[model samples]
Target: MGSSCGPTGPEPGAAAERVIYLDNAATSWPKPPEVLAAVQHYLLEVGANPGRAGHFRAAEAGRLVFRARRAVADLLGLHNPMRVVFGANATWGLNQAIAGLLRDGDHAVTTTLEHNSVLRPLHRLQEEGRITLTVVRAAGDGYLDPDEVRRAVQPGRTALVAVTAASNVCGTIQPVAEIAARCRTLGVPLLVDAAQAAGAVDLDLARDGIDLLAFAGHKGLLGPTGTGGLVLADDFDAARLRPLTVGGTGSRSDSVRQPDFLPDVLESGTLNVAGLAGLAAGIDWLHGPGGGPEAVGRHELGLRRRFIDQATARVEGFQVAGNPAGPAVGVVSFTVEGLSPSDLGQGLAREFGVLGRQGLHCAPLAHETLGTFPVGTLRFGFGPFNTAGQVDLAVAALAEICRQERP
Candidate 1:
């Protein structure tokens, strides 16, 4: 493949760099400078348990948490920040949403492209005889047909429909808007797992008809690990779902039962103050006056387009996966002929210092839908810090590896 973009290395006086980070989907790298600063500041300046005390430090911590909630709410175009409940990660949020919503005899629908987070919980519920689940099949590219979802919905019995906004393995963006609209028409709640599309795509809770959205803060949101949340729509009440964990919420001290409130009801133990502080800073950096998710998304999309073009043109025996026509975020996945994805991933890291992810990417169902199960595929996810030049280098490295490893 010809290199259309120039290389992006360290500055003139800077020391040598180790590797090119391309595994943003697993967890973003090179988070904004403000994110690090915010984490440090929180740890040093205001290290206190939020909502646990009335002290200045405690109040400050509480304010930081609230600010993060508002930031997430604004990003999703949600009106109430309280509806955003912080969790350990997207999986945690998904567990809370699924486990809470589904009850005995309730019927639910989900896509075959869902990550383990959604599938595992639903499977457990099925085993326990709590709810009946229907796994809707996606196309070869992992694109779920909204009509499939509509057909799966059994008006009175189907209480909720869970779907992924984008496939983590194939980078196929689903018709979430159409699915959500169908769910709304059927009066069934729609829970969206935006772990792969949150910051890389524009999502309006109201316009998109998303009743519940689970996202990872560490991925596209550019926050530290252990930061993620579930944004509940106004019509969707958190009370319908039971708390996953309960301990100290720093509220209703006198009562033995947990407080029944938006955040307080869901947030049990002490929150990840440092991570939340960084998450707040990250949200601001992404949605500030000049900076916005759309701007960052465009940059990522350019890199994806460049990679797709280069790989399609020159990389022999390589097959790109996912819906080419549908709009994708920054994620892209492909398989090299006669080469195991794990081997290609290791070669990219060891030989070329290009860090990309391999295997099922915690979404075996997605690979199963794409017909790349067990062996999986190599995934290269773009970030705000990633440049088009990096995309060129990655493609070149893959092509070279294919040539050298030709069977």
Candidate 2:
């Protein structure tokens, strides 16, 4: 798909050029024009608290949110939109899933490649003596073996298996289908954190045997920040979970207790109407011509291949992290010898006007698994708006920085 701005030439003077954003995994930039238009439309034409009032405006707001829910459901191949619940972000959704499902003495298994969103919650649960956690170690390349996960599943006690569809740091796509198959055979619920893979790859909940899918709308979904959701299969009962939040859901107004339903049971507050409106538009764009997950993934892989070839050949002391052969989204991380990732990131931003992410990327476990802890690798995440020229520019900037630092 062509970028929002048509075929502009590269900015002049690499050091003084306009900013080139390569941090889509953190949050996408230059959102689709339709997304901005939808947000504006919601704010100007229909601004009302959704699911709260009977007026036309309020009803329109509710419809917009519902349409967003339906769009997300369709994108993920979910049958029921009610099963998809929105939250502030993926971390919030993940916390709700973990805290709601696991109980005292129940066992849960997860891979070492999980982000802090998954690890921190499970850690707290473990510390509280609520559940026993079995962390299946990944290979040195940050790829988890499905057999390892299967081995970790203790049949009767295992309640859930939490795994990321792809690592935000290393971009290693897990074998979620295989893991889900094992979970199915063992009768354990499989929850996938698809923060990095949602809009970059096709995720069929039924086909993949995924019981629960958590995704960040802002990252790969090309939506605004504070938009994220969870998809629950019909077989996964909400009754098994404790409501993370309890308050007005615009349902059961006379009752004091929260409503016992899918969305209202968990939503518990005023919805992000504008954000959802944009998100719905973004999903629509994704489903439209040349903008689905497959097309996006192929485009990104082409960029990644270019980056890998150029950086490895030109930049000395730079090594790509994780298994180069593993399937990945648009995210790529690499380490530079004798330079802190933060420093490199700063230089890239200040000198080259290239915006990229640094540090452990909220996935300390992943960095630990990749042996890139303490000093993390520099990450460049591509978005739908990024171009091949931007990738080349980023690589050239890195090579120049290395030369300057060494010579």
* Candidate 1 structure quality by residue, lDDT tens digits, 320-352: 878644578878888978888898999999999
Model 2 vs. true fold: TM: 0.95
Angstrom error at residue 101, model 1: 0.9
What is candidate 2's lDDT per residue for 189-225, written digit by digit as tens?
A: 9999999999888999988899988999888787889
lDDT of each: 0.85, 0.86
Q: Clashing residue pairs, candidate 2?
A: none
RMSD of each: 2.9, 2.9
Question: What are the per-model numbers of colliding residue pairs?
Answer: 0, 0
